[model samples]
Target: MSQPEPGAVVDLLGVLAYAELTAFDRLAEDARLAPTLTGRAALARMAAAEIAHHVRLTDRLVELGADPAAAMAPFTSALDTFHESTRPSTWLEGLVKAYVGDGLAADFYREIAAFLPEPDRLLVLEVLDDTGHADFAVREVRAAIVADRRLAGRLALWGRRLVGEAISRSQAVIAEHDGLADLIITGTGDLAGVGRLIERITSAHTERMTTLGLNP
Candidate 1:
């Protein structure tokens, strides 16, 4: 693969740093909706992990000579809009968002990282690692569905909505950030490659939904 464009790397890191920071914030807020102390604490740990990931991304941005705040600034509005639009009203919804919604974003980033130079690619992969939320979410959500089969229908719809919002916001982020767009296009080799990337992410999302006992 060709060397990743330095500007694109910075843009990718900047957006990822901002995304992690917001993930921490969203998770912490969602913790309040948890039905039990155990669930709340689990979410709190996940929030801490997100902040830690944010720090790593920011540190890498600084190493690349970009101000962390400046790099993250451009993404704040878009990311915030997404969270605000999709804010969960129930603990179960929060869990699904953490699992399915955030998982979708992670899958997209991981796909693009394949096009990056080794160092940045590895950093991206590392920061995107699950913070134990996947199993936690799947366990909790599946149990909830068992207790109230009706919930399966509701959450399935929620998952679908999250996918649409996520894909839309993702496209917006890429379009707004040319460096990020270039990285994905360059890495994928063409627009069709980008389509295949989306297909993979969507397929993964369906698998995650099924894992949660929800209809894809």
Candidate 2:
């Protein structure tokens, strides 16, 4: 496979960078949904990591001579739509969204990183949420379900809606940004490769839902 043009690489990096920034902000805001101080603190800490990632991405964008804001602008709407459409109604619902959403995102990034060159690949890997975050989310979801078995049904339904909204917004991003799609195809090298990437992400998401006692 050929290396992506420098401009395309910059665009891709910009998207990733901006994604981190928005994620940090969103997570911080969503932390208020937490039922306890501990849960709120955990989410806040996760948000802090996203801020660090945003800064790193911004620095890299500067090194590459691209405007970080401009690079991120194109993606704002789609991402905002996803977050808005799937805002969680309760503390347990929030945990499920974080768990399911971040799991799929991490899996997607892992597959996409395989197609990127050195530093970018390493950067993406570095920004992935550690197992601690996933475990925290899982524990919260499990405890909530155990407290009220009926919650399993509500949270599971909410999780499904969240996934659907996420997919819709993702497809919107793909449709709106040819450059983003190019990055994926160029990195992976074909439609089949893209499909495999999605398959892995979806499978991981399913497993995460099951682990939380939710029907995928």
Candidate 3:
């Protein structure tokens, strides 16, 4: 018989599976706020990509002998809360949220994946790849900010709010999921290492803000 998968690995994949699925939902909703047909189409395409990634994660969960639904259940509340709390009120805010949230999650997951063995690490990184939306967000947000200089300040504040909400939700999730916490601690070799990991993620977020012409 095949050996059972590690709990930490299952936790990682489970959370990611739910995250991708919710991202699909969020993007589809955001697409409705698009000012132009082209913008709507772009977000629609990105939403499709999110669903595809969700399927990939669910498939891997099944192969590991876990029910995809059960694996994702634990994360539903936390992720949902995060989304509801950060729902964008405007088209530009939606675009900024997508860009900033995706970047933050990608950075955090990439750091955690470093601790995972072989195929799991590869799978996590693969699903976390950009769904071709970053450049679109950058172009859209920057153009809007140029037309209305006040938007730069507003979106900059929005970006900071997104980061804060994401990090807070993540910490709650980590505390509740011991396996996930252990994975991070083990991968980092200690609490201090985990701090460094957060620092790196924060640094990446600052760079993403700069790329969008927003204040970090």
Candidate 4:
């Protein structure tokens, strides 16, 4: 917290702003794959939540004297690559992606936010709030698996792939953005702190998978 704050806070907010906007778009597109009207509507609600978060972050960036669009621009390419590479081929896969991918990102960002000064840290946590969709995703996916037990194995594998892609993209982001890496390392107080943060994220993911009756 002793180091300069504006650049890191702005960068973090920018990344989050774009992430939320893209999440809204992705969830809306994925909704088309939903098997039922109720399921589609649920995804639609989650998409709305993402947009709300995006607006909050964008406004915060402006209040901090940053252009929302310009701040989000640097992360646009990398995040797009991440979504493109991890695009879901099936409705079930999309649910698993939404649940697992979003959870992982939230966990990681929350951990880093702990290192920020009071203002940015609080704003980041608030924006990263759960959309109350985890339970819905777990219930829907579990019901589908129960109806077709064979789907369990496929979805478990899909969850693992999402985790893998998330990790790869995160590593690339860190390598390409020294400020982001510094923000995380400094927030954690050291590299060991970063390791523990990642461990926490993985543990949380395992719990979510188990809740869904999927292998971690």
* Residue 131 miss distance in model 3 (angstroms): 0.6
User: Model 4 compared with the native: what TM-score?
Assistant: 0.96
Return the TM-score for each candidate structure.
Answer: 0.98, 0.93, 0.97, 0.96
Regions of candidate 4 where Cα sits further than 4 Å from its true position: 1-4
lDDT of 1 by residue, 152-216 (tens): 99999999999989889888988988888878888888989888988898899899999999899
User: Which parts of model 1 have CA positions greater than 4 angstroms off?
Assistant: none
lDDT of 2 by residue, 1-216 (tens): 777667666766776787787778777887998878988998999889888888888888888788889888887887777778877777777778777886776676667666677787787788774635678888888987898899888888998898888788778777777766787887777889888888888888888899999998
Clashes of each: 0, 0, 0, 0
Please tell me which model should have the higher TM-score, number 1 or number 2. Answer: 1
lDDT at residue 59 of model 4 (Cα atoms): 91
Write down the worst ten-residue block by lDDT for model 3: 1-10
CA lDDT scores, all candidates in order? 0.91, 0.79, 0.92, 0.89
- Cα TM-score of candidate 1: 0.98
Indicate the residue-level lDDT of 13 in model 2.
74
Residue range 51-150, candidate 3, lDDT tens digits: 9999999999999999999999999999999999999999999999899998899899898888888788899999899998899999999999899999
The local lDDT score (0 to 100) that residue 180 gets in candidate 1 is 86
Local error of candidate 2 at 150, Å? 0.6
